[model samples]
Target: MTSGPDPAEEHSADVAELLALVARQIDMRMPEIVREMRDLLASRIDDLGGDPQLVEMLQASIEGNVTTICHILANAIDLESLQPTTAAVEYAARLAQRDVPLSALTRAYYLGQSMFLRIGMDEAERLGVRDRVKIDVVRDIADVVHRYIDWILQLVTGVHEQERRRWWSTRAALNASIILKVLRGDSLPLRGFASETGYTLTQTHLGVMAWSDLDADDPARQHELDLLLRRLATAVHSPAPPLITVVDRSTAWAWFGGARLESDALARVEELVMAVPGVRVTLGEPGRDVGGFRRSHEQAAIARLVALSSPRYRDRTVVSYSDPQVALVQLLTKDSTTTATWVREVLGDYAAAGEHARVMRETVAAYYATDKNAVRAAERLGVHRNTVRQRVDKFEATLGARGVDPLQVALALRIYDDLILDGGDVLPS
Candidate 1:
């Protein structure tokens, strides 16, 4: 027309026309691509056997063209060559988003097959870039994404396990601390321990003692002992509260305070001990204060020793200080056997002399037995009121004439009884 319409203007018009044509083609193809992608992804989801609701949501999003799949591909793909069809490009975008380990393999296979099908053998062969661009590029990108996702998942799982173990360790340590505090005869901070350990402090304090055969072959006895301590703790309650402690593998100690003892607490302890063969219990007396607790424990220890020496006493039961025999046993422990022997020897002659000697001995024995109770002694012997009076009179007369004090007679009788039962070889000589 006019020298082929100025060269620069013609070139510009040709570029604009080409760009418009490409935009129109994409607009027309996008709907079909979306529909195809939705169908394929739905089929894959069904094969995966995941939740139906999640699958349906993914299907609806794809069918609605909610994601910019084509744009995502445009950014990721090589632009030097003609791009693949929207379906193939969207498939690659979906695979990239999924970040699956084998997604690269799938993407490479699809890209290679799609390129082979779309281009004639001659064009693909001439490009010489087919293997590098189509196969290697997709594989390299997908591999990087897959490795990242795997690393992230592993990090999350590792962190979670570490936190769980720490939490458990903290809890165990707290429980042990609470138990130790109680065993030391210190008051338990129930609210504080409960808050820190995540355990209820109310009714948590208990008292227990552990005993094992001096010769038993249980290597796991320590573990068993802890279990027994926990069981006994659960069964007891107190205000200051009892706590568990391992005195040794063969012995454990528990203490409880601030709780009222039922009349049957001792009975219950005995029952529990009896059920376990060869186990013994030495229950401390209920004490209202620190001083009382010390005395109570001392009494319990002495009672246990006495009980061990006497076969007639029942096993696995509390021997209260108020028990008459138990009191006598404690008294004997407080005095020396040598002193008892001397007293018995010095008093024996007077006790053996006449018919009045028997009465005087009976009176002396009764005086000590009744704790010097003249009236109670009469009642115990089933004698006439005056007969006990007469016996007591004779006792004083015999001791008085011998230049012995009435108090000495009483002391000699106590020593005689204790020394005989204690199995001391020294007799009145």
Candidate 2:
């Protein structure tokens, strides 16, 4: 006759049965567990939520990890046989692509492990097993899961680091870094800088910024912009290929090297840009040497800002730092609301909306352009000289009894007509 089962064997059977029971319970609550885990991560981690694509990746990672943990418990899968799920590895690579810190990624894993462990212990307790068996079951679950995370994390860490290194080593990434250092005025050997960037800093440079109104992620549009810039560089007879750095998917900065851009060169650039729908460009004044390189880019940046801010220039393709009124407008728009109020104070009734205001602005602008000569101003506006004189007189009088600064009044009129008068509505008033 068979002897009664050994106590050790019986104890082992009890633990095994309890572990499987807990795993099954957790499996049934998989949806809840996964949802809670995702919600918890999103609330605690900035990188995990808010983007639809990132959220999709997050869901795949959570489901894969949770399902694998549940399966390991149910099947008593050997810990040595475990590997990181494909989704998990892919998710890590994606985070690397987005430049999320490895610390953030590793923190998520630890958080997930804690969450899984808590669920497992809660399930074991709800199974109503004896305290000894409950302890044994939880101990087994914890050991297996902790080991799994340790192993998977080691591999995932390698994957993340490898992907990050690979991403930043790409030509575009490398060039972008070098350009940023220059833009920041970091000290570097000028000869080495030219060698590394294939761009000479001592030459005259025309700073240009190009952007598109289309979808920011459209690769075709970016390609078109690149082609347009190269063509522009060729048209301007750049001694070297244009130095271009993509600022984003839709925007890029470029430099065309030359002695100086002829007046006709700008006209040609505009003509080429007009061929591409939805594309816009801004150009800075030609600058010499390193100081010119930085200053020209700064001017281009300011021109871009002014163009972007103005509804009038929203559809116009090309703007330049040297364009009439752009320099002053750029300065005044730094504090838009204050400038608007100042404009209102200076222009008085001329700042208000209407045809009368428009006519008054044209007359005054032409008058200023003609050096306050009413005859020439009338000729420019195609209006009677008396009409120009009368408008100018009224405009000056509206500047109030103390009389405003003529220069300030000039700036106010320019901004009002260019920026505030869009759609017949006054902005920042």
Candidate 3:
């Protein structure tokens, strides 16, 4: 009938077009925006007495935020209500997991919202979006984000609270006691205690000391620490339910008992499990019997020390005691302060060379571990023999002839682990 377009429909169409333009602008700069937001959010979190762990966590948050925004801008009309996106809920849960006070999260949200508005307004002018719809589009976007945040916080705080109650339960005490006594080398019957602890002593076991890298356990994060343990146990398909003890708000000690342990268990775990936000897992080699149980636990404890005491290693989510070099490192770094001194003394400027230092030290260690055979070392390290030979020669050149001795070489390896692999960060305060 050639009727004029309905004014309401035309207005809606204009709004959608404006939003789509804004979304496009965001899409073009999303990568840079993510980096900026991560840094900004990290700063805000720090100001709020929160110890943020891992750049990866912030990266995930930014990606999630981008996805939600894109979805809303594309389908604003079809969406009847604002729903908390997966990323939003996960963000709240992670904050709770890190024991970051709820205020920190809300404060960060406000800061983020303010930044978004500023950016949107600036982009609106730059993009020459129509004035009639510009303010409305920004408001709609804000509304979506605000509603998502509110719904997510309400939902996840409940999850955190439930987990908190579970952590504080008497059952938690029983689990901790049974596991702690064994770790302390008490003479408990493996079977009897196994029945009580949901751990199967007869099966091969892998011990894990799972915890956050923060300086102290924040009570708020204990629930997430608890959940991290449970999730790991399930991911690995343990023969029996895992045995876990909450050591504190930031730390958990766990063991997975399996009828047969996978040879690539550590690799599998690194690929599948450790990438989950905010937790570090120090793993012991698989073993059996009560002795294996205790040994693996002790090894994992040593690996944790290596991981936490060095800033290089601190960033790593997984540390395995299975590697002979990692074990040797345990010997070198039994005392953190002393080992640090040794690394500085032995390697001199090279101790802090970062990745360069790791590659060289790894070459020498691989060489030594393979019985000083260059071909085998090359094979072991999966590098060309020439590369192995060159690194070894370079290592010797910097430290001189004495640096090549078996014992001296061993010390150098340990030093590298401390200064390079352990993240140069100081031990937790």
The best candidate by TM-score is 2
- Tens-digit lDDT track of model 2 for 1-429: 989989999999888877778888888888888889988887788977777787778778988988888888888898678777899999999987765767888998899999999988888888786788888899999997898888888988989888865653464456678888888999877897788767898889989999988877764466678779878887777877777788877888998888356788888888999999888999898898888888999989989988888665766788888887788777767776777777778777777778888788878878887888999989888989999988888888876677757677666676775557544454442
Each model's RMSD to truth, in Å? Answer: 23.3, 15.5, 16.5
TM-score of structure candidate 1: 0.39
The lDDT per prediction is 0.47, 0.81, 0.69
Superposed on all Cα atoms, model 1 deviates from the true structure by an RMSD in Å of: 23.3
**What lDDT would candidate 2 get against the real structure?**
0.81
Clashing pairs in 1: 239-258, 242-255
TM-score of 3: 0.48
Best by lDDT: 2
- Cα lDDT of candidate 1 equals 0.47
Q: Which prediction has more favorable lDDT, 2 or 3?
A: 2
TM-score for candidate 2:
0.56
Clashes of 3: 12
